[model samples]
Target: MKFSKRTKLNIILLWVFTALPMSIFLYYYYPSQPIDWSIFMLMVLLAIATTAIPIYIGNVTIFFSQWVTVAAFLAYGAGVEMILVQLSILPMIFRVLFLQDLPYRLIFSSWMFIMVSFLSASAAHIAGYQIGSMDTIQILLGATIFMFVSLLSNHVILYSRERILGQKEKFFSRDALWDYAAGLVTLPFAVALYVLQLTMGWLAFPLLGIPFLLITYVMRMYNTAERANIALAKASAFGHELADRLSVEQIVNMFLEHLKNLLPADNIYIIDNLKGNYVVMRALEDGHEMRIDVPSDTIKNSFIHYYFTYSEKQCYVKSSEWVHEAPDFLKNDMNSLLIVPVHRNKKTEGLIILTARKKYAFEKFQLDIVHLLATYFAVSLEKAKYVNAAVEKSETCALTGLHNYRFLNKTLEIEQNRLNSNPHLILSALMLDIDHFKQINDRYGHHAGNIVLKDFAKLIQKNVPEDAVVARYGGEEFVIILPQYTKEEATKIGEKVRQTVEIHPFLVDSDLTKNRLDEIIYITVSIGVSSAPEDTDETMSLLRNADRALYIGAKQAGRNKVAEYLK
Candidate 1:
């Protein structure tokens, strides 16, 4: 209903171009005979009826009104034919106005129909078409020229419009071919209808109208079934892709990517509820991923909360249906919306929101497809969570929550291979031991020793660089693997660890004292450092040298100290 300044200008220009020439032509070429009002009204009705139901081929909609127009032209003249053609476009314009956001299409379609009718009629008149004279060869020749010009002019206008709009589309496509073929096939029917009208009078309408309506109905059914089949196939393939993903992030990305292919959307949002707190996991605007932080109050005020709380899937064909309840985050010039709650075992886990800039942008079938995709996402997320937990249990130390010996060995091999590939790179290893660890267990209890070990792992993790790999080697011993560290750097890190551990307090239960109060005791660690190519090239040998230095260099000389491999 509201048009921008540019659209108003285009509509004015289009109307002038269409109406001005048409008025001048009609004034100059007025029919000499008096018009038959009843017959003309009947022809108008037939044309309007045909325009109401169109057969779709790909992106093109083929209307059967061409035959009715041809019959009208033959019975009357080009002037009347042009008028009827313009009037017939009203149904399609109304359809678009109510169902889409493309108001410019109203004037554009009018302009296209006016030009096509005028130009094609002029061609037929030039080819010796005359009202009230029905000769077989001349009629055929004139109708053929008219149909050919009509099809060609339509494509020319369409291609020009597409090019002006910056679209890369060829003038002739399979849809165009279908249009031409349909026109040719209906030419004879037009002639037959005109001939039948001369004999059957008004009864000739149903003779042709009934069969055309039937064909349109059948084609509509077929197109619906075909679309449903294609959607199912695409959904199945998308489910397979989701199943192959191994992480929640991967699944979210894949869902967004495929959902865009399934429908036209201007924005997408993935909102997850983690322990009763709503968080925006992912967002995409205009097909590009974006980071957005929405306040909790805004989400609570929006329709997302309603959907999540009720576990309902909703589709809004117009903004008015939801604008009253929408928060600031949902008021982004969007008109249509589809929100589906992600459910797992009858509990809502998250919500998926898709929005478009046009009315009726999302259909019912698309909503169904999104529901199926949500199910697929929930299943894949559960599978990935369990798979990651299983993998972590295999590679992690249960007591200290650090990498176990198995992971340590695997990491060493990987670091050694990386060092071998780059001559300039260096790998460092640190072997650390808690000095007199058994004495604490004997004095207090083994439970106290376990607490010390856990606390020591936390301290080591806090001191090391994030990229460094720290693992519980065995007992009170631990290993650290540092990539790209020299021997001197590793020794400096080892000294830092030794100093921190010697001054740190370890909390333990006073079992031998038989007191309710827990006691804090001091502990010390001996550390040894070794580097690749400086100590030995092999990974295990580097570890062995660091271990030898920990016992012989540090443990033998002092209780708590840093030592480097002698070799």
Candidate 2:
């Protein structure tokens, strides 16, 4: 990694502060007194075994061999403790030079150990901690203080280097907690070693390797459990997010996005076959999209059909088999696939296909989570379909079989936004009303009136321009929204409706006999035309202006006349 100028300067300052004092201390306090060759060799052997397997917990590397240093401190004083700790750094340095590890990291690790060793030794001395006379309480207290000082110094240096390098990890994070826990875990071992050395002398050193391996195994299991808990937390969060979605499209999008975050794949396809037709929503890792429309019959005859028929609810196909069994369209450049069938009412509703470029990209845990998500997605799909059907029914006008006022409100709001963007685009609103509609109801009964209204709506729809929106605004008042039409063009269209209604013979069913009337009744309509951005740009304003013009120019003047807003 390349360091910025600021980071380089910070690393330089860290080396100066920690390495300078540590160099001076090591030089002045070097074990100059006559050394015991036998004990020295034993200490060296202990140091090698302790630092052999450096447990990597997040960004920090920990040696479970701190018990050896603590044991040496209690047995042979500060000189032997410092010498044993320094000996551990030599193996790490050799690994960096010959095993091609980063020299900067190893060098920093040496400095951290040296600084931590000085503080821990001083803490042990202040606590009156000596070899044979120390009780269990003194040993525990000294070990705790020694561990705390080492951890604190290392945390400070780690955070300083990370901050300078623009790293986004917290100082007192999971790794620091694990380091503290490791210290606590090694305390009993350290105490045992100290006691054994006092009694058995140099013979006790070889037994350290057994406890060190057991600590390594226990720490590995702890790390695995931590990762599993994290995955479960994410799955729970995603489940809540999926539950809150109101539409099938929204739920599908959220599921796809959440799945990508959990396990990244090169290509993903969600095949929803429950809607009578098959819709394949495909997304590439690079963010390109492909929406495939496959006939349901094709799916029924393909390998997917066979799987749904014979296989269990969840399916996993290896790359070698998937390539041969998958359909031609799905076989395009995909290596591995995971297919999970969404279940509802004890039957499969749809299938989710996860594809990646590499082989064996998915794990058992990810498949389990995908199965859980698919259940929610199936429920969301059913709810969305029911809601959409109800909304469609509510927006329909029962008498004329056209859009009601509620639907008109939504359409007008959309049109007004469009008019705002394209100021030059012509939009015309025609307010049409049957002439003497109340007289027709009273003369021939409501059944005849209903017939007349339905026929009139049909006539208006048939005569209006293509792409025009027609809706029943209320009883006997209909609205025609003509897009891309001027006031003159709309007036001509309005004239066509007025002429057609005036000439066509409207059939009114007999009320008493429940049969068609022999004589056809003729009716006319009064139309008021208003163009958007010409008369008014607002939907409500345009509507009010058209209604006003209809009353003044059509109804007041006489019915069966087409009138445009004067102003």
* Model 2 per-residue lDDT tens digits across residues 63-140: 776777776666565566666777866756543331222445655666676777777767766876654445878777
Task: Supply the TM-score for candidate 2.
Answer: 0.60
Please give, for residues 439-544, the per-residue lDDT of candidate 1 as tens digits: 9999988888899999999999988888899999999999999998898988888888888888898888856676745899999999988889887889999999
Go through the candidates in order and give each one's C-alpha lDDT: 0.82, 0.73
Residue 565 miss distance in model 2 (angstroms): 0.7
TM-score of each: 0.79, 0.60
Summing lDDT over every window of 10 consecutive residues in candidate 1, give the lowest-scoring window. Answer: 26-35
Model 1 TM-score?
0.79
Best by TM-score: 1
